[model samples]
Target: MPDQPVDQTTPRRGSRLSVDDWLEAATQILVDDGIDALKISRLSARLGVTKGSFYWHFTDIGALKSALAEHCRQSQATAASRIEALASLPPVERVEAMARLLSDPRRWAMESALRRWAVTDESIAASVDQLDCRIFAIAISAMRELGFSETEAHARATTLLYAGIGYVHAHGRLNEATVDDLHVIIEILTRR
Candidate 1:
């Protein structure tokens, strides 16, 4: 017998999409259509499944939004962990890695979307604020590893993070010129 092509339009009677799948679809919708488009019906249509599948994964719309926020928080934590693990590398190299990570287009889109969402939601605003602090702490620690005093490292980390955020907001995508400019900025910021 030959294998049949799976039909995405209709899921099997007893099978359903995972929570991750729904989240990914919601993220995509959030990125492309903004928070207003992140409703369960829209996500179900995007995923080619039914609203029942979403309910199976999430108790309600609020639960889904909380899950999405948690996902973003986890992603930031993972990035911070990776940056911390790069302590063995030169401080300049570590700063460059962090710059590249911040400049990533996908991350920028998700961040921009979340920032937009945060404006109207206090919970999301709190999460964003916390994530920003964690990122700054990681950057400051990396600068300290490069022999910078605590105060100087804090100032430098603040400068680097602000510059990166400004660049991301001003130009969501990086070009060669931006990459070269980033290298220069990292060099200056990490200079001991």
Candidate 2:
């Protein structure tokens, strides 16, 4: 007898996708199609696994959502750490560096999608709120180094934070011209 070709359509009793695999797929689905697309059935089909595989990792959709929240938090922390590394630089350079990094389209899309989802989802909203504070703290610190008073820095940081996020979402690109315009905006906001 010869070895048989395994039938991929059949769900093997012990075969299953790992938690990381699930998270990756879930993240892609969310990024591509939004939170509504994260159904277990869809994920099983997408991953070539059975619903049992998903169930093995998560007890329910809520459990999966909780995992997703944690993943988002981790991602935000990673990005913030990268931004925080610029603290050693002068204020203007720090702000410019952060702006340029964030202005890329792909990065903008990821952040925007997560933010839009958070707008309606309470769980995501809470996670985003925490992320927002971390982002604000860095921006304010940079503004203060640029000669703005504490109150002025906070106000300017908050304004620019909203503007940068909105610009990426609305314009989809922060090219040289856009970045130049943003610099003007920053100047206006930080002016005493």
Candidate 3:
């Protein structure tokens, strides 16, 4: 039999979308639009699934919203883990990875949306703040591991993280050549 054409608008028969699919779609919508646009009807239309499908996965829109917040928390945890894992690599490699994270404009879209939502939602603002503090702590610890004094570690970590935050807020990203230039600076920092 010849392969059947797949419809992009809807899922195949007997196919079921998982919770991750729903959550990912919701997060994308949250990023592309805003919290106000995160309604059940809108999400259903966006996902090209029925409203009943949403209820099968979530009790209500409020449930989905709560799940979305938790999903964001989980994402933050994953990012923190990635940052911590960078410690295993050499200093130049580590710095390059950090630069990639900062310079990738698409990397921080979800967090950017969260920040916009945070302006009105105090709870979300707190979550964003908590993530910031956690990243800063990880950064400072990484710097200390590199043999910097306490104050110096704090300063380098601050510079690294603030560069990322500033890019996210300013919607800027660095090119590969600039990132390559950063390696020379990292080489300087890591020399004993």
Candidate 4:
């Protein structure tokens, strides 16, 4: 029997996959498993599609990896924008909001995964470092708004950023208690 013609447009189950869908699946896999688990075969399986669909969206694994890092960078920028939008709020309140945003479990996992990936990938390391600097700058700006001089604000923001990262790393998941603890830390940091 002659082979049946294959549909090139429609994906498996007639579900067309977009680039965002692929990126999201990649991010989830990266977070759930590790960098090594983010292969094209695995992502295609997770998305219920074929390698052709993956290739349709990304040129190769390297391109997919770059897209993942860019996606993460954009996510961080969105979070930073949220904090920046709260500029009208008191500095302490702004800090609390930033803390709440950073304590999100999904974000924590993504950051942890990226940190692990950075250990072996110099490009990813640079991206992660840039993200850290952007976050720190947002914190410092918030601190300066609270009447602290630039130097003091930088120092306080550095401490707060490190403490927040440590807290999230230790907890892995945030709850009311963690949030309350975070508020206390913010209070102490921002105290005159």
Candidate 5:
């Protein structure tokens, strides 16, 4: 979460949580509990702060939710820059790193939480869809780095990305994919 400048009237010292702090607390509540659990009182209490602090940052819960949705959109807006960074890496290394999408458990959990939230909110759902397309584009970039034609890149990238998505969403209930499973996948996907 990007840090917004603190309100001037807010104390510069002890327990003075910034706007970013509130948003992060809200996100934790959203991911760990659910959207319904995102009450201002609950979040303030969780952060060991007062409601005054939250109010200092946001007018109300709706504003906070809107901010969260906007944050989600802004966070994924780095696809082009990310692709450029990936492009700088050796082709084989880039492909290997991109194909290891399921390696981060925390990221998977957050994405899964956002997906669940999307089911009930159109704004959030749109954000998720845009994020999905952006991530898919990055995967496609990775495949192209391996010298695959656009059509071939789309097919392989789609297959690999969808597989990673499925694994992430189902990961809470199912056993995690083993290192060997990932090795076989990385080997197959990176094969020229």
Candidate 6:
């Protein structure tokens, strides 16, 4: 299970933590334990600061969650840009580019965490849904340009996004057969 909610008590000692520090601490907590484990008190304690400091940076837990969501969104945008750049090579090259992008450990970890958090948080779920829609739009456009009908393009794009998410989340759970399976999936999905 995730760590208990943050301890919201007084600080142990030292100067107050900055917003960046709080965000970093929160991310660490989320990464190590999970969203359920993130508590304001525990986060403040983790930063060696008091819960009051958290108020300085955020009005409430919702505010802090918004910040986390923005951070994750920015990180995803950066990764998506990198993926797009690599995918610009050739149609064949795009497949490997996407595979490499989805297979990265850090990206997978962050996306998985964001996805899990989105499950219990409506705001986060909305944000992720928006991002997913935008990504699917891009993929659909690409598919359309590659000769698929509009409806077929959208369907393929949605399938690719779902498969990509599943691929990254189930990384360690797969064996060598996974790559072979992915190759077949790609062939079927990307074929004209």
Q: How many backbone clashes does candidate 6 have?
A: 5
lDDT of 1 by residue, 98-138 (tens): 78877776677777777788888787777677767766877
**Alpha carbon deviation, residue 39, candidate 3 (Å):** 0.9
Pitting candidate 2 against candidate 6, the one with the higher TM-score is 2
For each of the candidates, the C-alpha root-mean-square deviation to the true structure, in angstroms, is: 4.3, 5.3, 4.2, 5.9, 7.0, 6.4
Per-candidate clash tally: 0, 0, 0, 0, 0, 5
Task: For candidate 1, list the clashing residue pairs, or say none.
Answer: none
Better of 2 and 6 by lDDT: 2
Q: What would the per-residue lDDT of candidate 4 be over residues 76-187, giving only the tens digit for each residue?
A: 6676577567666777777787778777766777778877888888877877777677668778988888899988999999998897667556654654336677777888
- On lDDT, the leading prediction is 4
Runs of candidate 4 exceeding 4 Å displacement: 1-14, 144-152, 173-177
Better of 2 and 5 by TM-score: 2
- Give per-residue CA lDDT, model 2, range 105-147, as digits (tens): 6676678778878987887777667667766877899888778
Ranking of all predicted structures according to lDDT, beginning with the best and ending with the worst = 4, 1, 2, 3, 5, 6
lDDT pick, better of 1 and 2: 1
TM-score of each: 0.76, 0.76, 0.73, 0.77, 0.75, 0.70
lDDT of 6 by residue, 1-192 (tens): 987665554234676666777778778777777888888998876777677878989999878877987777677677667666754565545654566566666666677788888888776677677657655655676677678898888888889889878865775577422567667876787788
- Candidate models: Cα lDDT each: 0.77, 0.76, 0.74, 0.78, 0.73, 0.72
Residue 98 deviation, candidate 5, in Å? 1.4
**TM-score, cand. 2:** 0.76
The parts of candidate 1 lying over 4 Å away from their true place are: 1-15, 142-152, 173-177
Q: What stretches of model 2 exceed 4 Å from their correct place?
A: 1-16, 171-192
- Flag regions of model 6 displaced more than 4 Å: 1-16, 52-56, 83-89, 149-152, 171-184
Give the C-alpha lDDT of model 3.
Answer: 0.74
